[model samples]
Target: MRTSPRAHARVALAAGAGLTLALLVPGAAGAATGTPNVPTDLYNAYQPCATDPNAPLVVAGRGSGVTVEGIPRHTSPSAYYLTEQFRYWPVADPTQIATVERTWSTPGYEATADLPGLVDGSTYAWQARTVDPSNGAASDWTASCYVLADDTFPSQPPTVVSPNYPEDRSSQGGAPIHLELGSNGVSDIVGFQYSWNGVFSVSGADIGEHGIPHYNDPFDGPRSAVRADTLGGTASVDLMPPSPSWIQDLYVRSVDRAMNPSPTYHYRFRINVDAPKITKLSNAPYGKPATFKFTPDAGVQAASPVVSYTITRFGSDDPVVLPAEPSGVATTTLSLAPGETMTVSSLSANGWTSQRNWWRDETDTTTTVTSAQFPANTSSPAAPGSFHFAPKTETSQIASYTYAFGWSDAPTTVPAGKKGELDVTWTPPYSGWYYLVVHATTKDGVQLADTYYWFGVN
Candidate 1:
């Protein structure tokens, strides 16, 4: 439990913080039977950003609100304040931006007021008080809570420099790289947060218990934060990247004291020292499974035999792990579409992993439908044209061809000829560009990928 604001304020005053509070006697004119206690626990009411360093930087234009609550006195004769008042104003100018009053027969009610708009880079202060509308009596205002309205991101990204692994160049892997993070003209920047794989979580410094903004140890939290030197605004760290790639990037962001994050600075470099070699073992036609082998580098395999290969195929973000054979080589069969590629990384018996190696398969993607009478995009409106479709290969046995003039129309299907050839005729619909999609169903009941044909009806 937190200390009562009355007691805490007393203590703060005793400690010579120059704080003061007004006390009205019970007999004062039109005063309530018992005085309402000054409000306690004033903070940014936006729960998502209410915690710690985030509270101090209120996101302007997001309907951010402030909250303050009053705890009723528990004396024998309790006071029932009928109303609560909450208001916030610019810190520099005392003009009120907004104010809210709530009626509450019960005490200890929370008052929330929304800030529909605030000037960027400006600071605002808020306070709350309890009042008795019938008697026109009110408690002294609570200590003010301050928040900085910051709609702007940090000015710029962190200035990054690396000695061991310079930018855009290859360097030996399996060792830590020295990096120096410096400020980029953002005066309030306190540290740099970075990650090897561009995935990161955010956190900030804890605010003082009294809702006062204090910067005593802002660097204590944040899993990836590196505090800069207080005087020079620079810090150095040695970071080791796991699972190197042909082009590795250390994504870094500058974090201000208020926890505002800057744009990412991609610290790019290469670390392809001991990657596995990819070789095509067999060539199968498009849409058919083909075999490829992954072998570790000679020097790497001598020390630690390859155990498995991690392969990430194109069109998919997930990686698949394939165990290696007894000969320290791994092979996998994959059915890939034309122009698809995959990246492979090998793990060794000694728990070391090689860098990523890229491989591409040569799969033919020739269009099965061709037209001579209607060379693409040249036919006028109502012009009739004939299209011819043939099997992809002599071995491929297509049953029928299903095609549609455009996405909105119903598709028409025609049986293939004895020799697996298809012929169709259609009149142009309009003098504009149009597209036709065709899907071929193989005799084996497997549907191959769809082919798109684009042309214009002049």
Candidate 2:
């Protein structure tokens, strides 16, 4: 868009490092709270030749902020604009000598120019000419100047490299966000905080009681908007249910210590929730006897998430959902019937059906766990019955880290349609959570269960 000396107009526009834009509104852009600039009458014939020894440099055209055509440097890059020409100034002049700026322009030649001046966030208009030592060919005056940026008001925005210009991206429940950000221009990065829908759940499955996944904000310092460790081109974080299965248009926003946040980035994704997978079966290592807890080598499908399940002895039509006193996503203990069979399955999200099966109808008298086959986190210290559960989650934040281990005199019974509770007891050799592995049970001695979970310890 070209600007004339009549209406002082400037529109709101974003600028890239090497690109410049001049808004031609009657006022400045983004100044929703201010008025636009009015064009002034520039009838000055021409700027006199420079008195300095330099020959290629000509006086830039004049205006409130007559400035250079581009950034000034000792030498020009490959594509720098040497100068320009203009039609008669005051546009009202008809017989003017085509108004060549530095007299270097050909007769009847015209020029126009836009320039960003010394002020960091301001722009001004003026014409410029290039002089050649050999022939002194001055180009016509150029006008229509523009300024690139003015981020000095609220705070200094981070100088992010090209793309990853924005701090955060959006994601859904099962489909996580793979963030790639470049912080080459930023230094002294303390770290970054992530808020999805809202800040991540810092209490529960996240860092838990362990001194990790901590959060202290306004985050008062200059830090990368992403995380300190996420500079290696890629970072993986799982998307969990804020509303879980209830889908919504979610967004991610990040800020620097200067509190300059990238514009909110958003996307549309639905949570793909499946019931947690129960991989194998066994007995608990430390938790109470079989009646209270039955071990199941369970795993969550990396591609699919199973949120809930049901557990019952074989041949029993009544199978109670796990997580006995289920609050959120949970696992539960099913009481064993001496001669009865057991069945465990991954429950569907829209509600349950026989569609998915995790484990099924295995008799207690037929089940057994070789002392050597049991993981030490549960059985190592017999008095305490140490055990370990490998609990893997499909989430990026927290959730799959808790374990249900230790002996509960009364095997917490999983009521019909509901799940049971796994007793928690911290002992030696085992430092975290562990639940029973129901799949380990076999047609041998009556061991019924063992503690083998899907997880990792801090």
Candidate 3:
């Protein structure tokens, strides 16, 4: 016989009261049967509830939901038809439920409820109960299950703090770069997604298993993931590739539980292992300074501007520094000795030093005297023979030539066009032997070849 609504209501109220009484009097329900026929499934009739679901794992704004399973109240198969009542409330105030949802099935074993319009990053509690459809028999509410909603994306992009950040130029053997990141005050950051040569952007079609959308064009391969509750942290990465010519650009973005992404941060840099080239070393005369000219390596010039140059002379530890001018040429004056070895190296604005080029100074100032002539032997009071001086080569290098008769007397200067020769008539006062000498000097005042002649007087 079908039960009236009023009768059903009374039966449900009585059943609820009886379950409470059964708890208070443990053996009362079975005592009437003269045997302890206690209902083993009595707890199952109480309500359907989730077993230990972690809410923090749920994607907040992605319409994520949890499933609650029913417990049997009695051994009768008909009891499985009971209707399930599920309710959820914010943890802040459990007295009021934010939403109530109901579901019933032929077997009525479980219900997958939807939690719509939930605030991101909030804590909530949920509970469930069962009502018998035949007689309106209701069970007690189950224990509340607490969940943490983590749907909010990080507020700021991660800041890069290693490899000198924004701009860097280094040699191939430089130390691995330590990439540092920081949180934007959002503690719910689940992990980070990064691309080596690209930026991060939201994708409309690529959806994750949790119903959250993933970023588009993560890269040539899967995006790298770093899991952490707090995003702002650090990691060591090999910024330099195997070859110095391989440059790198990095982009990173933070991801929340809902897969929402933060703005992408970027870093750009290159490896310039090759040093600059010393193109020319201008020859300086004996007393003048030499100029060293250099050109940066092609890779270094493309990577960044050359800031300065260092010129080192062989046999000296000190170096001369020259600034890189607008012409892409760096020049420095060095007072170098003839045949001295000098090396030139280039420096980038970012502090990368190039290899050095070595060359020898070629300036020369030596005068070559081909021949000198005077009387080999002569008697005292004899007339002095003609004296002639000739240069074998580099006559332009001659500054002046001199002719001298003795050590005590000053020599006479020979004009350049005169072929370095002088004619003199001198009488030896009382000489056993009179000496004649010829000296030649370069234009720079460097003494060159000297010739000597002798005469006997009696």
Candidate 4:
């Protein structure tokens, strides 16, 4: 039988269609072949552009004109088409997804899309895939690529100020050196890096990968960059040195989230740690002036000349400023009661004060004689009249009183109540001048008070 071209074509078409269906089905084909090949080499070429170390980390507006490129694939060359899938979320989180899609014509390998509204400075992920228009089959999605959309740099450097002036000269022992850094014009200041060294410089490579400078040794090491909000409106640091020495220089710089660093600022100072010393001289007798000598410490001389010294009493805070003597030695006279204590400290020309030194007056002896009455200067040959007098009130606690005549007889007790008057029957020894003296003693055996009357017998 002769077959027509149309009938023969039908037979071929039916066989080819059956074979194609068999291949498209999962279990009946040599290879499951309807699905399009997965897209390859997907990438974001310019939409959310690559980060430029010199540019700001966060851009101001939404990212657009995001060009995504890929290799479109398909089982049948004529069916090749592309579907670019873009997904975005905060770099901080990826589970919550926002998506947009763009379709390409057959053989097309690239697509331009828009991230309509995205947060500034945020990073997002995107991907693309291919599809077979003939079988309605889609390829697996391409690998994801990340892009950041930031473009603003911190505009101003931090303003560093210190209430404690001459920070270098102020010793750590005196008070902690306090510093305040103002966030000037920067909208976001992440943290600060500071160093104390002998050298000062404005130019140096960024210490951290983020562009912050390292605070090298001699100073404490590099500090990790902290969040800007955590630092608030102003950042602060307290510095204290263990001993007295010259703090030659201090350097500081500020940084933002974009890794932008501010110009370095510097401060200079000389530390003074030395205070003055107070030395106690021999104890002064009661009623005599007690003397104390003040001397400057070695550190005082090393740091600066002692222009003047301030001496403060132990019980009082008021200071007495005195000119420094030719010798570093200064003496002050004080009269104190028995058992009373005195303390004094010295202040240097630079206003550095020394630790207070104390001195106690020696227990008082030799009582104060307020009044006395006895025979006249000249007495007849007979015995001198009886001694009489009103007793002086005890200024300090008194233990006992004694009466004596010209040092001839042993001291006799004048009972406490008898202080009003005393009868003297003893005759004066043959002497041109005789003295009748009364003495008072404290419980500690200190002679606290005494008085005497003199008489002459011709």
Better of 1 and 4 by TM-score: 1
Best of the two (3, 4) by lDDT: 3
lDDT of 2: 0.30
Please report the candidate that would top TM-score against the real structure: 1
How big is the positional error of residue 198 in model 4, measured in Å on the Cα after superposition? Answer: 9.5
Taken over the whole model, the C-alpha lDDT of each candidate is: 0.63, 0.30, 0.51, 0.50
TM-score against truth, every candidate: 0.45, 0.22, 0.35, 0.28
RMSD of every prediction: 12.1, 23.4, 25.1, 25.5
Model 2 TM: 0.22
Which segments of model 3 are wrong by more than 4 Å? 1-84, 98-110, 120-122, 130-139, 164-177, 184-190, 197-223, 228-247, 256-260, 271-458
- What is the Cα-based lDDT of residue 107 in candidate 2? 17
User: Which segments of candidate 4 are over 4 A away from where they belong?
Assistant: 1-153, 166-173, 198-232, 241-244, 273-458
Regions more than 4 Å wrong, model 2? 1-177, 181-193, 198-225, 228-239, 246-249, 273-458
Candidate 3 TM-score versus the reference: 0.35
Better of 2 and 3 by TM-score: 3
lDDT score for residue 216 of model 1: 24
Model 1 ranges with Cα > 4 A deviation: 1-35, 45-83, 95-98, 101-111, 115-117, 132-137, 195-222, 240-243, 275-353, 356-458
How well is each residue in 1-458 modelled by candidate 2, as lDDT tens digits? 12333323322222221112311112111212212121122222122222222221212232322222211111222212222222221212223222222212121122223232324322222333333222223333334322222222222222331121122332222333344333334442323334545443121111112111212233333322345453212222333333333344445443432233444445444333333334323453222234233222122323233445566555657767664222224444443433344545444343322223334334332212223333534433223433322212111111112223344322432211111112233333444443444322222222333344432232
Q: Give the per-residue lDDT of model 3 (tens digit) for 168-228.
A: 6644422344566555555656566667756444422232322222223222244365555
